[model samples]
Target chain A: MKKNITPYLFAAPAFLVLGYFSILPMLQTAYYSTLEYSFFGPHRFIGAANYVRLFTDPHFWATLLNSLLFLSVTPVLMVVSLTLALSVRNLLRGARIVRLMLFLPVVTPVVIAGIVWRWIFTEETGLLNHLLSLASVGPVRWLTEFPTNLVSAMLVTVWRGMGYYMMLFLAGLALVPREVEEAGILDGATPLQQVWHVLLPLLRPTLLFVAVVSSSAAVKVFTEQYILIPGAPLDNKALVSFLYRHAFERFDFGYGSAAGMVLFGMTLLFSYTQVRLMDREQSS
Target chain B: MRKALSRIVIITASAAAVIPFLWLAATSVKGAEELFVYPPTFIPRTFQWENYTGVWNAIPFGLYLVNSLTVALLSVVFNLLLSSLAGFALARYRFRYRGLLFGAVLFSMMVPKEMLVIPLFTSVLRLHLADSLLGVVLPFAVEGMGIFLMRQAFLALPRDVEEAAVMDGAAPLRLWWSVMLPMVRPSLAALAIFTFIGSWGDFLWPMVVLKSQEHYTVQVGLSMMLGTFVDNYRYVAAGSLLALLPVALLFILMQRHFERGLLSGSGK
Candidate 1:
């Protein structure tokens, strides 16, 4: 009899907090998305008007495009991180130190990464342009120019993300059977061929995991936009930053929640896929 | 020859990886004069350790550190207790709605934080938790990842010990405390370290809830300082380095466990 009730007692505390805070807020976000809501009240119900505004609004469209563009950076990120992972994972000695060095960026706070990277691309005395000048190249307006502003921010994301994804890939590599790689060599495969033919297939699960996780982060990135170019003209607003500007800056709660809902939908799509893939992996 | 090439590639990759830190360490120690040279030297010619002192005094940086530590500690404690309790329930006892409850937990994990910020802040505002450490820590205290990690840990425990204790008339809670908790130390350590590391560096939620400089986390303080220290890049760099010091140390000390925790939680 006591056993029958004990589990509920144990789970109740966490569920209570989660219910009141996390899950409830998601419902509130959806509810507020349909209304002219604020700290004061949800004064009026305007069904899908906020959604209509988002579809028609040029700013919304631009940020939506930027969200897609931001996510596109993941492929580049994966390639670079994979390359680094492969290189260091097979090292005979001091692999730990190399992995530690690479992983440093991941552990560093995002805002600090943002500020430091922003400084690195600063026009006059920043590191990148300083290095460029010694090669007799003129200073590029990395933070000031149109596409460069967005590109520089994307570069920072790739930098911060590489080590973390490298760690994931290394974890995957550890699970791959050694005999398979040796067999690839015995079949007279080149190193690149061994990777392409043998190791890459085994790494599919990790690749999917990285892709999904990276996509969610990429679409929802805020710190880079906030720190690098806070009011970074309409051209480069990621969805979360755009939501933040409206909800916090302009106090357009309805519009912001509408935008937030879209972010939620995108996250759901990715996470649902990830869960499906992961559950499949577990079953297999 | 291939080994040599791979080593060079690995070395160069690591060097590139640490370039920001290299630049940060160099820039933070540069005197005001040497900072704007036409092409700056990679190394600081003169070490200006005062940047650290200067930045620390420029604001209530110490207060930020204290507040961040407080929030992180509260988050760690809450997560440990709540997650372990929930984990034990899900992994041990059979209950009606157990599946539904666990599904809710999984679904809650799927909700991107951006979706919750507005309503969450409004709740924080209503409860008067706004501008307090509790507000910053409350939402994250019941983390899905921690619960999931704890559940996995609990599930892996051998059943015989629990069954033996139960047959001896041990109460559920008693068996949990006496027979189960000791065996899951590694997972608890992993959960606590990850929670501490995450809570310590979190910015977005804290940014929304916190309005006062007095309650700012280090991440918030750094961003806020960026606004005030446009010309004082060296100072900002120093502040950035100082903020990352503990995080780096923690990672170095628990590098293996951190990797294990991450891989077990996600990499499997």
Candidate 2:
């Protein structure tokens, strides 16, 4: 009993803090989602009216579509970065520095990355446009167009995140026992054949982690869209960005909470399904 | 040879990776006239070192730097202390709901922070803690990732050492501070570096909570610089460079530990 109490005492501070800041707030959001509460409030319980309104709202659907579009980019990034990792996995020299370079963007703030890329993709005096002009391709209004803005945001997201995923892939690659690879090679298998037949199978867990994390991150990407193209031409708002505007800007707290709940539900479901599948894969 | 070709590939890949940052740094030094050249100046003719000074003076950057450092340090200290305690419990103790508590922590990790922004803001507002440093730091202090990392690190330690400490009449706190913590120094260092970099780079939370100019973080200040009509590209670039410098240095200084932390955290 004393021993059990001691552990609870040790864990108390952290749980209390998490409870206050994270758990309590989450509950509060759920409560507020059912009520017509704003910052300036004469509040009344509305019993899922906000959610009902949220479903019918055009902007909500647009935001959901934008989130879907944002999510599609993650698999492409994962494949690219993982491929890069696989390509360089066997290289002996300077792999560390290359890995470092890939992970550099992960440390840089998302807003800063968005700002810098905004400059790169700027229409008139942008570096990308200037480069494109030499090839007579485009002065693309990247941050202005409907799907283009989303694409532009996705491009920056991929560029910034690829390195981090690459590092993860590198770690996964390292875990692929060298002896196993050597055995495959000795058995008259080519390098590609060894990787395909032996290494990729061993990397299942890491691949699943990357897929789940990148997908979750894709869903929650607010800083890029918020910083680069806030309400860009009416049709380019990401879900989280729209949620931000609703909650903070318009003071529509209840509606925003409903959106938050939806996002939470979607992320939870996706993560659950991924983890379960991965665990099943591991067990089998 | 394959070796030579691989070397070329690495060099090219690294170059592609680094070019944008190099461009950002170079553009920071170019004069306004050279910035918009037809053929963009890869190298600035006259390095306008004043752009650094200019951006520094343009905003309350000195104050902003202090605010950022203060918030990040507080967050680091809070996270280190609270997470270490939680990790010790989770690792060492066999409580009734240990699995449940651990599950809660894991669940917190999956919940998107953006989803909680509305309720968090309302809570902070209700507490009348909005636009304050404490408000900004408090919420971020209890990170699930830090707790999870520390718990994993602690669990990896041999139980005999801790048992020996207890047999030698060392209390739980003493055992933790002296024996267990020192054993997990690398993990703690890794957590510190991760938390420091994360807090330093945080923008949205600071932007939401910090209303006063005096309390603005570096990211917020930089964003404000962009919002203002002052179209000084050099200054903006310089500010961006300065904002990035500390984190870059932090990464370089703790590269090994950072890599280890990333590997462990990603469950690789």
Candidate 3:
């Protein structure tokens, strides 16, 4: 009995903290979504009113559409990061330094990186425009403009993610049996063919992992958009940023909680798929 | 030709990865007039080391730095202690509901942090931890990833060692402290550094809770600074580089552990 109790005691702190901070809040987020609450007023039972408002709200739809658009960047991220991983895989020298350089952006805080990228994307006196001016091109506004603003913000996401997904790909690459590659060579497969036929099937798990994680992150993107273009119009904000604006900035907690529930649902779907895939892999 | 092409690709990619640092460093030193030049020079003609000093004084940058360091260090300490305790229990004990408890940890891992913010802020306020560094550290103190990583490490330990320790009449806590903890030192190191980095770089939660300028972390401080010092990019650049210094140093020192941690954290 003492021994059984000892294990419980050892685990109690962790469960306590996680229960209060993580599990409890998750339930509260669900509960709060059903109420009419704000800084100006007390909590009132609104029942489905917040969700109804969320569904009818044009800003909510636009923000959700923007999140889906952001999710489209995952394929670009996968290709770029996988290419980066492949490019460096065979290098016998300087690979470590290359990796360190590439991973620097990942290590930099999003606010700092967003600030640097913001300066770079400035229409005039920015390094990017300065480079384009050498070819006598008109300086294009990168951040404030409609589509370019979202595109530039997405570029930052891609930039920070490159080294991260590359590392994941490299880890997956390390697990592939070497004799399989040799067999492909004996079959007279070119490098690209070897990749397509030999390597990709093995990398399906990693690709799925990257796809799920990056897409979920894209849906939850807030800092990059917030920092890059501080007052970006309604169409430009990601779903999380919209939630943030309503909840914190405007003190509309119910509205924000409803948006949060939607974001949570989307992320939960991705995470569930990832868990299923991982479990399948383990069982096999 | 193949090698050369790959080299060019590698080199261009490396430059793309690194040039931002060089550009940021160069910009941090340039005079205000030089910043407006049609083609910004790669090298600053005059060194403005004073910008670092200026930005340091512009806001309570020193206070923010201290707050960030304290919060990160506290997070590392708490995460190591709590996660390892929980991990050891899960790995060694044959308690009922062990699988259920572990499943709960995994489920919590899947909960996106964005969903937790509003509710967490409310929780923090209820606990009277709002506007404090503890507010930033409490939710992340025992991360699911840390618990999972430590559990894996403990499970990998040879069973004979624990049996030997038990034969010596050592209590469970003694066995954990003297035998088990040292065995999983590498995992602890990885969790420590990762937790420190995560806490240090955290922006959104800190931004939400830390209302006073005195309590802000460097990330929160920098975001606010960006709005006030809109015209002075040099100061902001200097402040950013200064904030980045410790993390860069830690990464260089612990790159191997970081790489290993990254792969393991992803369950690869």
Q: Which stretches of candidate 3 lie over 4 Å from their true place?
A: A1-3, A136-138, A276-284
* First chain TM-score for all predictions: 0.94, 0.90, 0.95
Instruction: Give the alpha carbon lDDT tens digit for every residue of B1-268 in model 2.
Output: 6456556656665765677788889888999888777657677899899989988887888788888889889999999999999988998889987888777777677677888888788778888889998889988788777888888888888879888888899998899899899999888988898888889988888898988899899888888777783568788788889888888889987899998877767765
DockQ of each: 0.72, 0.58, 0.69
What is the lDDT, from 0 to 100, of the residue A238 in candidate 2?
71
Q: Candidates' TM-scores?
A: 0.96, 0.94, 0.97
lDDT of 1: 0.85
Full candidate order by lDDT, most accurate first: 3, 1, 2
lDDT tens readout by residue for model 2, A1-284 = 45448888899999988878887777877888998978787878999899899989888898888887788877888777776776677677776777888778889887778777877777787778888999998878898887888888888888888888888888888777779878897899976687678988898887777888788778877888877886474347777877887888888888888998888887896666554553343224
Assess the local accuracy of residue A188 in candidate 3 as a C-alpha lDDT between 0 and 100.
94
Alpha-carbon deviation at A244 in model 1, angstroms: 0.2
| List of clashing residue pairs for candidate 1 | none
TM-score of chain A of 3: 0.95
For residues B156-263, what per-residue lDDT tens digits would candidate 1 score against the true structure? Answer: 777787878978999888888878999998898889888988888788899988998998998898898888877888888888888889889999999988878777
Candidate 3 local lDDT, B6-107, one digit each (tens): 677778777877888888898899888887686778898999999999998878899989999999999999999999999999998889878987887778
Q: Which stretches of candidate 2 lie over 4 Å from their true place?
A: A1-4, A186-193, A273-284, B1-9
List runs of model 1 lying over 4 Å from the truth.
A1-3, A40-42, A136-138, A278-284
Winner on DockQ between 1 and 2 is 1
